[model samples]
Target: MEDNVKELIEITALVIEVIGILVLVFGTFLAMGRYAFKLQGEDIRSFQKIREEIGRSILLGLEILIAADIIATVVYDAQMEQILKLGLIILIRTFLSFTLEIEIEGKLPWKQEKHRTTGKK
Candidate 1:
């Protein structure tokens, strides 16, 4: 019974991973197509839109990965192992989401160009 549960979890994890990879690849192609078709003055705006779409897609992938982690942890039902696995997944997904948010925004939240020009730390 337990072995069967583990096998199911492993299969679910594999499927989730494959779907996430496909999402990333498809998102990349969509962004590339958007950039390739847009012309001069509109290119920047179009690309920015593409970037936002890509970020959203990546976020969705991250969400699926998180779900898979949770499912695997539940299957294990071992306290220490489940905690560690879930913690790691949460940490990684949080960082990925943060990065995607910044990329979607087109700049660091509090970073200023003036700071760069003056070389102040």
Candidate 2:
């Protein structure tokens, strides 16, 4: 890779990773703040909503981090070991995202009939 392009890719990856981290932190605090405010005079049942929001943020953040990893790995390393490590990292993140999705929605994506607008089963 050209030196300039390599530097740009590295910086882009770093920025993406930072954005991912920020999303997780900001989302968690936002959800917590809302939940706390609701506790004062609102329904406590909103806990589930808050939990889902947090999980969604985590999922989004994980995906963003994965994108950053891909970009960095492609630009900075091509060794078999690095590729394997990237694959493992992606696998772990994907599993985490999958579980979070299930936890938040209480169902698999394909099984979400209610979440669909056409109401088709």
Best by lDDT: 2
Against the true structure, candidate 2 reaches a TM-score of: 0.85
lDDT per residue, candidate 2, 10-42, as tens digits?
Answer: 999999999999999998998889788875234
List, residue by residue over 51-121, the lDDT tens digit for candidate 1: 78778889877877777776666566668976886798779997898788687776775664455677864
Pairs clashing in candidate 2?
none
Predictions in order: lDDT: 0.76, 0.87
Model 1 stretches with alpha carbons more than 4 Å out: 39-44, 77-82, 102-121
Q: After superposition, how far is residue 35 of candidate 2 from its true place, in Å?
A: 0.7
Model 2 lDDT-worst window of ten? 38-47
Per-candidate TM-score against the hidden true structure: 0.66, 0.85
